[model samples]
Target: MTRSRAGGGQKKIPTALNATYYAQRASAGLMITEATQVSSLSTAYPNTPGIFTSEQTTGWKLVTDAVHQQGGRIFLQLWHAGRVAHPLWHPEAATPVGPSAIAAQGQTFTPQGMQPYVTPRALEIAEIIEIVHQFRQGAENALLAGFDGVEIHGAFGYIIDQFLQDNANQRTDRHGGSLENRTRFLLEVVEAVTQVWGAQRVGIKLSPSNTYNGMADSNPVETFSYAIEALNSFDLAYVHLMETSEADLRHGGHKIPTSLFRPIYKGTLIVNGGYTKETATAALAENNADLVSFGNLFVANPDLPDRFRFNAPLNQPDSSTFYAAPCDDSTENCGFEKGYTDYSFFSQLEASSRAE
Candidate 1:
């Protein structure tokens, strides 16, 4: 199942509400939880979940246990936001760290509200190793939390994505310049991640041609090809490949098709991005994807697989409540409980209609 950041993040600590939410959708074949930060510094926005602390891990355990009780397999997406992070989350108001000191153009949501992006402090060599260790630790925490597996978040212009692309990484060390160099950090993290979960239980999420967060690689095909080639060495379970339209945002011509990497990396290929039941069927029938993930659709319909099985009408998701902050006003209420788990199943909807 695809994960959505709907009406969450306001609740700093992971709560039973989250467990209840995931349990409601536990029928999915394999569920990937929302992007979870590896450390406190990995937090880019307020209310994002973390796996660094005992409290956080224990909280996630509740989620994993709930899903397991319902006989669902789930994986946690371990993430590091890189330069997208704000000092508001930092202990001493420190600057965010990235492959380079370049500041991404745009504002990030913080506890105080929207804040302008700041030029990040370039991480030291030691810090780079530390980041890899942090990911390894995050995997350990996920194991303790009873996750079936873990997916490394190397997409969406996050920390790993920042280093993979040419525009964001401008370093002269062995860790930058050529495609091989740019892939070093990601490969290193994967190595660490594999140590905790093993390659068969590990997976990666990558956005090869995406330009989100002002990303641009000189040669996306070559860069991702090299990175994926290295990834193949690990013999992972699958590579969750995400694709996006370049028209709205991002550089053109960099959009590499999913088939391009199929031969390069021989493993399970899960595709995500605006996929519908029909399109996903076509993709599978055409052998373009091994699996397809849906986000908002799953949010509006907990029994999504069954809905597709029965060709039932899907609930239209409300955009206004997609990411709304918590509300206390009795007349105007919106939050995790409302937008997260309140979506009715087909049976519930039918029962309500009959009563009406």
Candidate 2:
């Protein structure tokens, strides 16, 4: 790989070593892969993994095989970054597509120093139809790669969320304009993906009040309730909600009334977004969520549940090695293997302490 460009290497591309990373954490009842691109055009960052090619599918198969060998369940997080995408990762090197021509107000890490996001090409109705096919194809590939199921990355101002939010989607066609129209695209994708993985195994991620990518709805409570209601028809395995009622407000989104959605969405509800072990336990006990997804806690402690059960002190995460982007596109180990599979397990650390 080439040298890290100035201020780059933020998103590490998953590699064969990722199999080791997942395997180490296979003691968990469930594991979810990092959000992987459905196609080259859908990629928002360099070195991100895609499921569209044989090579990528084979790489994923290695990860899945490793996880299953340990009797663990895992699901692939399917993503299309939409306007967060830049031309660098697009096939033929073209501008990224969005529900509308408006650009997201943020910078994306490129081979060079962070570049301002480009104004995306507004997707035509026909292109929107094509994306449904892409999601279906991605789910089928995930099945072939041995994923237990697939999680549609519909949250955080990506393609599906772009279509869902009124500020981002300015279309007058069947894909946009009203609440029903906005919800239509997501439902179609759910339908398409379920065709490959079945409704029982399919899940979705939603950020009802996220403003990470300039996302805000005129009526977030009503807007999101309509979307959640639509999912009830699908019998989805779960709905992963990013509880953003508390966030850095300067980023610009409103508080999502997370409590209001519990009745609207009848499926298994999973909550994420900066949850601590204590808060997670509280959320489940209070019936705020059926499951909680941890990020750094899981990263620093591979056998995370064990630590939680015994009231073990948690290991702090290393901020520097969270993600690695290869400057020259070389795939070997991505960048540094520090924050990934190299993170010390509690057993390993305890053994070292005894040896010392």
- 10 residues in a row with least lDDT, candidate 2: 1-10
Flag regions of model 1 displaced more than 4 Å.
1-11, 246-253, 326-334, 348-356
Question: What TM-score goes with each of the models?
Answer: 0.91, 0.92
Instruction: Please tell me which predicted candidate would have the highest lDDT against the true structure.
Output: 1
Clashes per candidate (backbone, < 3 Å):
1, 0
For model 1, name the residue pairs that clash.
Answer: 9-47
**lDDT, candidate 2, at 40:** 72
- What's the CA error at residue 196 for candidate 1, in Å? 0.7
lDDT of 2 at 97: 92
Q: Write the per-residue lDDT of candidate 2 for residues 1-356, one digit (tens) a residue.
A: 01122111223334557778789899887787788877678767656677777677877898899998988999998888899988765656789999999999878786666889999999988888888898898899899999999999988889999999998998998888899999999999999999998898999999898887788778878888999998999999999888774552657666665656888888899888888888888888998889998877888888887677656677888767676654544546335566766766666566456556
Local accuracy of candidate 1 as per-residue lDDT tens digits, 1-356: 32333222323345677798889889999989888888777667655678888888888988999999999999998999899888987767778899999988678777678888888899889999999999999999999999999999999889999999988999999889888889999999999999999999999999887877777777888888888888888999899987766541444535578878888888889998888999999999998879998888988988898788767789998766666453333322335566777898888565456556
Look at candidate 2 and give me any clashing residue pairs.
none
